[model samples]
Target chain A: MSLKRVGNQTVVFAKPPVILSSYSIVGPKEGQGPLGKTFDKVWKDALNGEKSWEVAESKMLQEAMNGAINQASVPKEQIDFMLAGDLLNQIISSNFAARQMALPFIGLYGACSTMALGIAVGSMLIDGGFAQKVLVGVSSHHDTAERQYRLPTEQGAQRAMSAQWTVTGAGSVLLGSDGAGPRVTSATIGRVIDFAVKDVNNMGAAMAPAVADTILNHFHDRQLRPVDYNLIASGDLGAVGLALACELLKQSGMNMGTNFTDCGVMIYDESQDTHSGASGCGCSSVVLAGDILQRIKAGKLKRVMLVGSGALHSPTSALQGESIPGIGHAVVIEG
Target chain B: MADQTQKKPLLSVTAEKYQTLIKQYTPKPTIIKNVVRAFIVGGIICSIGQIFINLFSSFGLARVEASTAATATMIFLGALLTGLGVYDEIGKFGGAGSIVPVTGFANSIVAPAMEFKREGYVMGVGAKLFTVAGPVLVYGITTSIVVGFVYFLLH
Candidate 1:
């Protein structure tokens, strides 16, 4: 019944919050990837002079957050809130970064979907007149993630062919109520979908259904088809997940066509030897912050939908033989 | 709660159907290729160990002592390679070949120790040194104990 509430699970902002500026900083590996030149800064080393990979990850997040804020030319004190998250236990990267930023921090834990979730929440804060400007950021590191989720960094275990390389990067976006940039017009918060995928290596397969569900909901709610957007990018669905998602969407009578692509697949090249593709919280965030927004600003892309997909399963849960639950959050950005 | 119970079975059915669809897209692991690579690499490693055994034997050590010294040497090499960050790449290429050897056992122990060393010596390396090798040791010793008991009863 509300004007903002759309068909089912979407919110159409009355006053869309504009993405004032965004900054992406990636490790050496990602900097060598296809979208390498698009990132704002590329660290020469993954450690970036930090003693530990965990510390490096937090530092990268801080650098990205500061870079975004500085690019927006907004005073630090004027920013209403900081929404940040990362692929780490207790979201230590974001929490540690927030400690230095000294802002009203809200640590999120949406795994890979943190970027879209943060943008959706930030837009709502602005559109609802609760905040003037908000900073949203997400980070993930390959070494740190591997240590926490899978095995030790130097462990000699052959990676599964379906396994994705966790992207070592951080991306931050600055949102303002009034700005001269692309606006976040609508959002579709997705339901957690578990297709009983137990293998952590096959994250793409685990997350495909969730992406399709969220995209379908977004289209239904917005009364817009796939053709309406110049690009509809899913977060970190990699090659396997993207293919499954396309097939699933087609079965639902929603043909995505050529306009649909995935951030994971786009980030790395086939020659990179990243079996499936790039993944992690940073995967979508960096792609969106670096490539997507830049294209929007350059007039190459108009309306875009970023559907961040996340495989929600802990190592403990996976060890317990529980199926991996997947989630996808959709944020529609219009130029 | 009532709604959840009613929807659970239906949800599971859909999930099952979706999994079948997922299988069509997921690529099968290259088992044959991996096995072949493993065989070649594992053979080369064992040959190197045999060479080490022969070298140690020429030094007047007994056959048993020579074999033991070769194993220790191989383990030391594995740990050294792991420290130098080369063993993981070898493991990647060799698959089970690199892992089935005594050197791989050393790698399993040394890798975690190196990774966790940052958390500090006492809690980090000391606690996690055997994280990957712990299961192997646990089951190996347990099975040996059981086998020993069986042998004693038979004797």
Candidate 2:
């Protein structure tokens, strides 16, 4: 009932309700290309041959949720809640995924930031003693995202350098009352900040305001500078957005260059030619699920500010001549 | 018997609707299962393609030409299958499997106009322009600006 209920405890009575345990996923950590080609491959692997982006995405979500549950050795029936979402309107991936898992659910839509948002809340539920076991998951498929959000790659259409490689993969974590893993220590929910750039398709610019807002919140709430974080990362800001974040951070009086980083800019290898870098829900998850969590588990990373960002634009909104809606969430995980 | 068959509507009509009418009915037509099939099929297709690429090398086809041929084959296969409606069936089943590749992108653009032709040119052909490509152009530019700016700052 009071703010004291959610204190900033590093060792907080904080049972994640369940251990983040282990995560499993499929992605293109090996090679990269144009966003569309990469996404096609992601869907190709994720959906197999499913032509429909929505269909493959739904299935990929199911696979990701299954990975969390199966890896945790938790049965579907035992789980109390499942929180998930994607970039699609109505979050078709999360919605359809919920259908397959047949678990109680909450559909989230924080863009690439969906994973961190779900993780932050799920961990809080465990920390707050609300639920004994919670499963938080998020995913995206390149093809599904492409059809829903952008071009079908075959047209050989050119993408701006700021465009991010929408990763085609799935990620999920099982959170519960176990304290053996990286504890969810503190979470700062970012309020929406608009830069007033209304070009709906141009999400990097649209989301900059939200990214700046959350990074500032993370610093303000923690009362610390960027040096405090071993790494301060943003979701799918890509190349342009990531650079913009640095400048924005400076304007906010915090220099994160010594530590600040971004998932979107990091996911791709140099070959990708990804102008901005990586975007979409799968970007953060793949990085987290693939290596970041492992490093944390190994005591390699002490503190990390993981933020996910998304452009909140609808197919019709872009058509209606409205600016993109941008939202971001920051989750601070400390060892 | 004929009238009864006509009245029944195959019950499968529900399958094509993308939504369910019955409240208590369970969610079926799992996309996950279909995705798995698509992966298997698409992988096989890719592997076969690789084999062709290798064969072309052995047979003296240059890399560029071989790659182009491979892409051409995929496009031809894509267009032909799309024309036959088989791609749509795959689209319904695997969703992304058939759609995620260069082929899926192909379908996103072409499928609409084919459906639209019945309505005449402006609505059909013109309408198809934005159906799939719109997201690409818009996100494409915005993402490019972000990427370019990032490169500018980071570099």
Candidate 3:
């Protein structure tokens, strides 16, 4: 079947980059709230310390980014660009991080969708001959997030079965113009999806609509079905969100069945008492950096679509009782 | 508080570190008959956990709390078996299919480190205490962090 390009073909994806280093930092056990240790440091500083959360988060992000870049055995001078983002208001996390990074930078605001969105842009830059070495990564946390949206980390509120476990970590990937990687084969930025569900406790309900619309738009643009890719991965939708997403896709006459897996669902053991499995910006990032990259390196999976869906909301919005406006971006990674 | 200054840290996923100890200490399962025996013993261990869960639930705990208690019970039993060297036999039979359960992980870790208890406090009690649980703590946190970041961004 012939493919129809969705957006302006300013750049056709070539080869992305390999994930040279991955680091995940968890919170205290059964703490009832969490965040990536460094992120929480920044968050706490923002909420309680001399510096803002953005400054703290960005500092930690740079530390993690440096950790990953150092692990890759690449010199700092070799990187061509820096791409980063998170759930902070107006992508301030990445903005602050960019200030410290002092590299050519692009700040993104995808809520939880930063990983895929970041990768998509990085790949485009690599494909369009815009960059040789682009550093892309994302982060999330439980404690800082809880403080931002719901209760304090010490609250110890009872979790519903559908509640998603917010992961505490950061993951970064270094994309270059050439060499070994999963290869950025194709991409589709579907029609922007927005809905009016804003309950902080029910993100799955809030984000599922966009997952449906964005995924459907991508499929329509590509003229491919769910089975075309070996894996149809979604970012940061826990077990319930995954189920809702599959149901919504099925409603569109595509039977994803068992093929659709959520980054939120894949990052943990079922028996971990994590409520509805993993959820975080890092949910997909680590899976992408740690496991998915390994699998791609091993040639086990081909043609994978990492769709990062995010909920754009703030503590003020939650308090003001405003509906959450969510978005999703699809980036295809192939061997 | 105990001075936590010194101790050789154990990496999580260090099953190879316990292999030698297991070979020397664990008794052969040939002393027992068949899967029935293994199942019976495993079943008994599991039953103890189930009873604990029920007991906890009966005391007005929620389902998750009860399950957590049950998990703790199973971990303790596995640790005991590991200490007695019987868990090695069960572990050989069950492989990870059985051992991947949190209880088995607890045993696999605690038994080996506790074996070095005779070496003294720093080596035995303080440092090696985490020999079994250390990696778990590491991976658990790392994994938790991974899951946390992913879900955190989803919002």
What does the TM-score come to for chain B in model 3? 0.59
- The Cα local distance difference test for each model comes to 0.93, 0.65, 0.64
The candidate maximizing TM-score is: 1
What 10-residue stretch in candidate 3 chain A is worst by lDDT?
A34-43
lDDT, model 3: 0.64
lDDT digits (tens) for residues B1-155 of candidate 3: 11234231111212233233223322243433434554665676677778998999999999999989889878787777677757666664544434556667776466546544445678655665564457778999999999999999998
My TM-score estimates for the predictions, one after another, are 0.96, 0.66, 0.60
TM-score ranking, high to low:
1, 2, 3
CAPRI classification of candidate 3: incorrect
- Mark the regions of model 1 whose C-alpha exceeds 4 Å error after superposition: B1-13
Tell me the tens digit of each residue's lDDT in model 2 across A50-165. 65556776777787778767776776787888989887778888888898888889888787789888987777777677777788778776656765666543332334434566
Candidate no. 3 TM-score: 0.60
Runs with alpha carbons beyond 4 Å of true place in candidate 3: A1-11, A14-60, A90-92, B1-155
lDDT tens digits by residue: candidate 1, A1-335: 34687766788898899999999999999999999999999999999899999999999999999999999999999999999999999999999999999999999999999999999999999999899999999999999999999999898889998999999999999999996999999999999998889999999999998999988878876678999999999999999999989988888778899999999999999989999998999999999999999999999999999999999999999999999999999999998
User: lDDT: which candidate is best?
Assistant: 1
Residue-level lDDT tens digits of model 3 in A1-335 = 22223432212343445444444333343112322222222222222242433344455566667766776688888888899987665666667767777888888777888888888788777766677888987776554565455532322123455567666556787877767556776666544444555546667656665776677766655567888988888887776667666665665566785668887777666556676677768667766766666667689888788888788777777779887777777887777
